[model samples]
Target: MNQQQFEKMKHGQGFIAALDQSGGSTPKALAAYGVPEDSYSGEDEMFDLVHKMRTRIITSPAFNSDQIIGAILFEQTMDREIEGKYTADYLADQGIVPFLKVDKGLADQTDGVQLMKPIDNLDETLRRANERNIFGTKMRSVIHEPNESGIKEVVKQQFEIGKQIIAAGLVPIIEPEVNIHSEGKEKAEEILKEEIRKHLDQLSEDENVMLKLTIPTEANTYKQLIDHPRVVRVVALSGGYDRDKANSLLKENDGLIASFSRALADDLNANQSDKEFNTALQNAVDSIHNASVNKK
Candidate 1:
């Protein structure tokens, strides 16, 4: 592990940017940026376009470690380059830590939750990520209701994979997201917290991990996790919230910081000139930064 990057993540006063839109979510992400489905001919062109979008964001003057400590990237982005350097290397050069999203995607919903599909060649992927200078990895699971067994399975799978990532000398961001609009959202969060605590307690003193959760129904819902000896940081996903609302909710949570994807790209448009795009991105970065570091 890079000690400098680890320290920055452990105590950095900024938010992480989630730029890791995988195959299923790529079209939606591109459409929001003003690229319609018809604009691309096939998967190749689609990924190429999304890569351009990411390159633009990374290269913009508005993005830097000052207010953005790290970025989570799709596997394709990790394999590609920005300005002739591998994506992770480029992020490091700009003082931003880079992380790769390693999960294939969600599995079919069962037991009121969707666990991550089994990741094939995970060790190989970890090796490649390490070779490219990535600092960590992020994987996601989803919960639709407060079913104890289901949520337990989600967390278990996460930590199991997390250990693999750790053995490879990288930290893992274990994300088990509760659907924001679920009928028993608060109840689900309550169960989720307890399950996470059990796993955190089992960690060896030298081992550490990060958490990326949905913005809870109540403020400080994950305070214990945030302060856990084994937890390096706790970040919140926007979970379909708009930027303004996401920032508002994040402000009420004292230690949690943002790891927003759609919210960060909400105001940006592909047709905008560089000046316009930069200004929009700057505003988004500023608002998220304040919400992350200036908690109410």
Candidate 2:
């Protein structure tokens, strides 16, 4: 999008809740919530639960809180409605920007690192995002270790695709996620930061980008990025950390906000009583909200 859009997001001072897991992740999440394997047999069945989750978030006070300015939605949820309103529209009405996950999932490993599946027809995807009034998009690629060459390759590819997304008039959240449990996590982040710098350095002074990074070992590893002219925001992924630990780590980082999936919904499961679910979600939201406001 334009600088104004990015500026609005920056001013919002919040994180993104990544509720866009698809396929296996969807069922796994449901099952964790005590939904039985036999509970849902198809994509439609699984999506019904997702929609309900969105509904909960939208109608809850947490959704209206200033701690969250946007949400990342699965393609299925893009057109889905809750309470007779399109999900995206629902988010917009609440002042939360809607962003779509456009990657096709992981492809074959490249030098022991898994790259994101190619965007088969990105123009069409962007078209849908546009029509849905989505404010931005997120794509993910994985870095397994501190393999400099592999990390560089993944970052390069991410930026290449990101530029195209920017050209399409939508902000792109370039997510080159480093495995948190991988060895040499700190060094890996250093390498990834350098690679990202290469891409940012190439952008014209007027161009802007946003990053969805894994929380680094060093709290301020991304300070340079936070200060960069073309960098709008630097957000972190939970990267499978539990909600408490995720928030604890996130709070230590300066100028980094969250875009969490598992952590954001850690306590939300199918088994919880409605009251219990709301309490758990509220607590989770509070932690993330507090961390986002601590902008370092």
**Which candidate ranks first by lDDT, i.e. highest?**
1
Which ranges in model 1 have alpha carbons more than 4 Å from their true place? none
lDDT of residue 280 for candidate 2: 82
Q: Scored by CA lDDT, what does every candidate get?
A: 0.96, 0.82
Residues 176-264 of candidate 1 have per-residue lDDT tens digits of 99999899999999999999999999999878999999999989999999999999999999998889999999999989999999999
Tens-digit lDDT track of model 2 for 249-282: 8888877888888888777866677788778888
**What TM-score would every model get versus the actual structure?**
0.99, 0.94
Off by over 4 Å in 2: 1-5
Tell how far residue 151 is off in model 1, in angstroms: 0.5
RMSD of 2: 1.7
Best-fitting candidate, measured by TM-score? Answer: 1
Model 2, residue 85: distance off in Å is 2.2
